[model samples]
Target: METQLSAARVSIRKGKAKPFWYGHPLVFSGAIQKVDGSPEAGECVDVLDQNGNRIGWGVFNPHSDYRVRLLCLAEENAPDYAIQDLVKRRLEEAVLVRRSLGLPSDETNAYRLFNSEGDRLSGLTIDCFGDVLVVASSALWVEKYRAEIEAAMRDVIKPRVIVWRQVNAPLRQDGVSEIIQTISEETVTVRELGVNYQVALGAGQKTGFYFDQRENRALIRSLAHGRSVLDVCCYTGGFALNAARGGATNVVAVDSSAPAIENAKANAALNGIEDVEFICADAIEAMQGAEGANLVVLDPPKLARTERDLHRAIPYYRELNKAALECLGTGGLLFTCSCSAAVSVDLFLEMLRDAAHDAHRRISLLKITRAAADHPLVPAFPEGDYLKCFLVAVA
Candidate 1:
């Protein structure tokens, strides 16, 4: 058994503190110091303090103004350890959580195992598509434990393949070389709600298909039958295709990205279905010209990058919703969503209400949706709960 730290001795001071004697392999703490000997962001250092005194650890951003994001208080005489243990433990916990949710490992091959800080594993993300695993290491700690993480996946999960899509450019600023590796196979297919999706292991957005919207798409399918559906910002036509399968009379899918439109068309073709229209244009313009659509689905991408961007984004959301409402027939359904973490669900709901008023239309909120079960949220981390979907009926 590893010896646990007794208690931490922490004090706020300026300057580097020397390590005290301790009966532990590792003692670490981050210090706040500037480049020119001025007080700046703190530095994380192994505690060489005497007598095994507990040391504090935190996140330190050297470039930005704020320097230390203290994660945990240090304890005295804590065992010195490698980051490999941390990564392994986090993955185990994530796996256990998914198992508790009754998620079949074989049914839907694509899912997220670890959501960076959300999983208490900082700077690392793991996405599983069937037997293939894609890993993105964004932090130095995760980079150090990469091999251990891969080994853990092999021993525990036994994934057929693993790929490392390292973000090296930003790490270069910190003097870290990015490592891209194909640890396993080069391709994999994922099943989402009974639909088969073939994605390149090394390519595609984030982790290929967006599994976060799995449940929401199912909900849209249930409501889209016998309706004229319009899917704005329809990347790859997940919603549009599902709506078509749901027996929609006709579906119009629009996106600004040409490649996305092509992929949507391809996805439609893959399903061997017709009676769907693909438009490569701005979502707002597409919504403006949309007519005779009883159901308008607006699953726009994140518009507000930060809190400061929200003020500018609210008007855009309002305008977009207003345009959709303008073409929505009476008693029509409007499935809208805002994936921006900066935009709170309350604020988004209010924006839609205001947009309806601006368009001189009355709308009733039918239901609200969030990310699927696979994307678990930690109570301490509100950022993990970013997805918000609203099903409204325009009266």
Candidate 2:
């Protein structure tokens, strides 16, 4: 049965094989020359070059623009492939990668375990917060192999609870079923570099916390000491609480969501840090009226969900950075970030440049950071590197 399922062959157009050979994992719809077998969505299929030589094996999605997400590259002398075996191997590899990074280290108990395409598992993302594992499925195929995937994860991390969330992804949603494992506690207190944060898996943003910002937040310890820090759009106070713990004399956390601000305050108090102030207001408006902060962090929600929104997103990114820049004191540090996959790093930097010019401020790019080690980037898939952090010094 497995062999028959994996035997479906797809041929690529004459010049389109270049990307597949060059290590790009996605085979676009238009690149396909022909499909020898009529494969349904989420089926494993063999991808061949124009010459009919097997190039790779991937998960096929007829409805998605990315027609195939290549899971295994063909070895020069080897010609065998199995979807189940590949999945088991990839899941173990992902766990080993995180273990190599010393993740869940002494101070941190939350991090990404599987980064979808980054982990060679293109359909789903799994994150670990303390003892709970949050599984976010975006591809319909993931649901097809839910049991195997969960078993594989259990073989590795063995988390106490696994919460499933089917993100309203752009991919086909047919034949997908929810997987839920009950636990008494829906919320877990996760520790990141000594800062304790209560992550509500039952309700909150992606995976209950932005574990990608761990390293960047850790950097605040050295830069925020004695500085008046302002964390704009501070969801659950990740940065603000860390800044306070880092010995910042005063920290102000602002978010549009009252619940988020409340969570921020609770997180601050959880650590017994009193110098931080929580404010519920539109981050842009708050920053526009705010000033004198020695350190400002502008980590907003994704501005553009798709390429069509790129032009509209650019202006919003510019305006937000401009407002935040105005709030920064001379010689202050600005930790600007964007999670918009549609917004490239260069474009974000350009947005920063325009914002600096408009604010009449001189901004020095001190460092460029990215998602924590756990959210590994696949060189061939630029979209995997979605989180961008720019640490700049404003004067």
Candidate 3:
């Protein structure tokens, strides 16, 4: 007795249902063998195995390489399920998890509220900045269900303002042309672990702040005592400020963005920190003369936007890390990071190793960390494991 999950059925190619069976949410166009009841984009459709057995359900998109992003497995797949309520339910679940982690507390009022695939909601990310919420929509389903999602967020997060944003590349990939914000607010000051930063509501970079590096900055603060530190691509002086607060004798931070440099300087003033120097310069050029610093941080922006650019982005990282290694001597520390989702942990570490070898430096990896706890990893979806960090002790 075979039961169809929905009116529109998408059958997986033979031998392609394994990944979906393991809870892998993405169903690419190539993996599908047949589609019945020609579902329109952003329509809720049931996914089936080659044998015509219902396996999962997800929203469909004809224009995307990822044709369907599975929202639930067969067990949870039921009759008359309100697809719109899934967004509300999943968002509430994400919020509950964040609350359990003590997010938006006295010390830290900013963090990632929803992490897309990591939270089982593909193409939607929510970052909280005090009372302001920034919603980054990167999928057709998210754009289609924007109203329902907003209602859910309001009930769950209760933010005073919400700003909608979409990465141009992702929007194109998802076949979503554009998205707009329902509300906006002025800049807000957010505190993270005793350090104060003035975040320009929708300016700077991704969601206006690097909350994924929260734990990493705190880790840098712990190890920066009495060291001369260089923070490259120092957006808003996150690592630099933490380094100065951590008793770094001298801090030189550099970024290509003039606005970022100005914001960093302002943040320095906000914290009454005068020891850190904010420089408006390209990261690679700035690092060439960044010697004498015992502690160096190389947190560059995303270089690999797509999988096709993986090979190209690797050489870039190799050169960047080599330059960073040149600034450090024996026993010096190098805190390097990559936020490219296309770059895997093994590949990133290998690139770091290649950089060290090319620089003629023997380094001991002290620790390897990823995005803070709020950004969880979904094993099946390795792309969810973006933001890889490495702590090295040069020898």
Q: lDDT scores for all predictions?
A: 0.70, 0.83, 0.86
Candidate 1 scores a C-alpha RMSD against the true structure in Å of 6.5
Candidate 1 lDDT over residue span 1-395, tens digit each: 22232322233234344321111111223442222222322233332223333344433434432233333335522223434444566678899987886655554667787776566654577888777788876655456556767887787779877888765643453335545653434755566766666666665566566778989999988988899999999887889888988999989999999988887787777778678899999988888778799999998878896799998999999999999899887889999998888999899989998999999999999999998888876564576678999999987
Question: Tell me, what's the RMSD of every candidate?
Answer: 6.5, 2.6, 3.2
Q: Which is better, 1 or 3, measured by TM-score? A: 3
TM-score per candidate, chains pooled: 0.79, 0.93, 0.94
Candidate 2 lDDT for residue 111: 89
Which of 2 and 3 is ahead in TM-score? 3
Across residues 1-395, which tens digit of lDDT does each residue of candidate 3 receive? 12333558899999999888877888999999989998998888888999988887888999999999898777864443355567677887888898899987898988998998888888889998888889888888888877878888887778898888766677788887654543444688888877888876656567788889999999999999999999999988999999999999999999999988999999999989999888999887888877699999999999998889988999999999999998899989999999988898889889989999999999998999989998977788886787889999999
lDDT of 3 at 45: 89
Candidate 2 lDDT tens digits, 242-328: 888788988888999999998988888898988888899998899987867989999999889878999899999999999988887
Instruction: Mark the regions of model 2 whose C-alpha exceeds 4 Å error after superposition.
Output: 1-6, 76-81, 172-185
Least well predicted 10-residue stretch by lDDT in candidate 3: 76-85
For model 1, the run of ten residues with the poorest summed lDDT:
19-28
